[model samples]
Target: MKHNVILVVLDGLNYQVARHALGHLQAYCDAGRAALYRLDCELPSLSRPLYECILTGVPPIASGVVHNDVVRLSNQRSIFHYARAAGLTTAAAAYHWVSELYNRAPFEAVRDRHTDDADLPIQYGHFYYADHYPDSHLLADAEHLRLRHKPNFLLVHPMNIDDAGHKHGLDSPQYRNSARRADIILADYLQAWLEAGYQVLVTADHGMNTDRSHNGLLPEEREVPLFVLGSAFSLDAAVRPRQTELCGTVCELLGVEHDKPVCRELLK
Candidate 1:
């Protein structure tokens, strides 16, 4: 493991939508510069549960994070904890929920779900509810913070697609447009991280259905994308890795060891 990692989780995005919007994906895959995967992230596809599974390499039910209202995670074996123990700086830029779970994590968390990462206080600008959390600002601010912090283990979430799906059904123009926007921003960050000698993994927590619903066992809700770039992975490989596998993949990338039911080395 000679490289750092930047994992961009496009919350609730699908491969078709990503391919249609992020044309660069297919191009990079064709050029053998990245690996694209379609995988299932098991039940309770909600963000909180999915994130717990992704970080701990364990299923939601087993991990005890079956819902979004999970107060905090005391899992000492979490990816963030492993990264810290491995002597790598970690940062998660998204909503506050991630920080709440990894609050004890030695991370420069710059989430605006309730706290502001800027000079302005809460009275000046802050999110009071999930509904008020705009993806545009969150993604933009997160991007800047990552560039500044330059953490070896970074988890950046661009959630406008999920937000759009919630507001407008899957078939709405806004939903597709939101996916396209995510691609634009992700592409930029991907390039930046790659140029800085960091491997990048882009995936989704879950997928959305036509009815703008999830947390079910539908194909759309279960299947999500896993795109890896600037790693030791074989380019253009047909990888159907599980979502939970990403946790250990990152640990392997950072030369960190984990206990019990470790995920496989996906990129290799």
Candidate 2:
């Protein structure tokens, strides 16, 4: 059977927080239905650069998206780009920076907010500008796009955790609560997606620190959780994965050729 894939990036989710807080995702790991990996996200661990790293499999220094302020169209081929090149549909319900990276540069809220352009890497997009935009709403938008387009590759990014971390330190109740909320929300749709034969990967761009900021080499700021659910994965705990391998892994799941390196040991 042909497989579809969904990549969910829960921004600013720390590995220890996910191991402790995300009960729903943990249940899957406990039941042997999902594999959980501790990944150290690329350095200069900010959002946009990590987003670029996650999607393009290129590190910030090489990708030239070293900071969140450097907003422009990405030069590297993303999973969406490879999927589209293979005549597959792609969709994303994510931050505006995602739209800027894969769809257009300098995202104009008026022109790029809700896009449906066949020529773009993300053929269907629901991009939001506000960091405070509710995760519930973003998930709803992703569900809407899924039902409407049935895209071969889907990207679902939510910002609430990151926003909470920026406002409150990573150790605060607010940050933990945000991760819990996202886990609760995922429980609503994950079963249906799995039943529908979609390969799903839930991870983070980067982690947050107790200092209420990132862009450091600290484990709390660099390590994040990766939860995988699908037949393509082996759930082999021995095979550690890096953030850069996500793009290649997704490309392989979609049966597309890619130059990015993949974590082959993690796959059956």
Q: Best candidate, lDDT-wise?
A: 2
What TM-score goes with each of the models? 0.85, 0.99
Look at candidate 1 and give me any clashing residue pairs.
Answer: none
Worst 10 residues of 2 by lDDT: 1-10
Question: Tens digit of lDDT per residue, candidate 1, span 1-268?
Answer: 5568877888888667775677776668778788778888778988888887787777888888888877664463677777777666676666555665665232233444434332211111122235335666666665665666666777777677888888886678988888887776666556767788888888888888888878988877788888888856655454457776788887887777676343354556
What lDDT tens digits, residue by residue, belong to model 2 across residues 12-49?
Answer: 99999999999999999999999999999998999999
Model 1 TM-score on a 0 to 1 scale: 0.85
Q: List the residue pairs that clash in candidate 2.
A: none
What candidate 2 gets wrong by more than 4 Å, as runs, is none
For candidate 2, the TM-score is: 0.99
Tell me the deviation in Å of residue 140 in model 2. Answer: 0.2
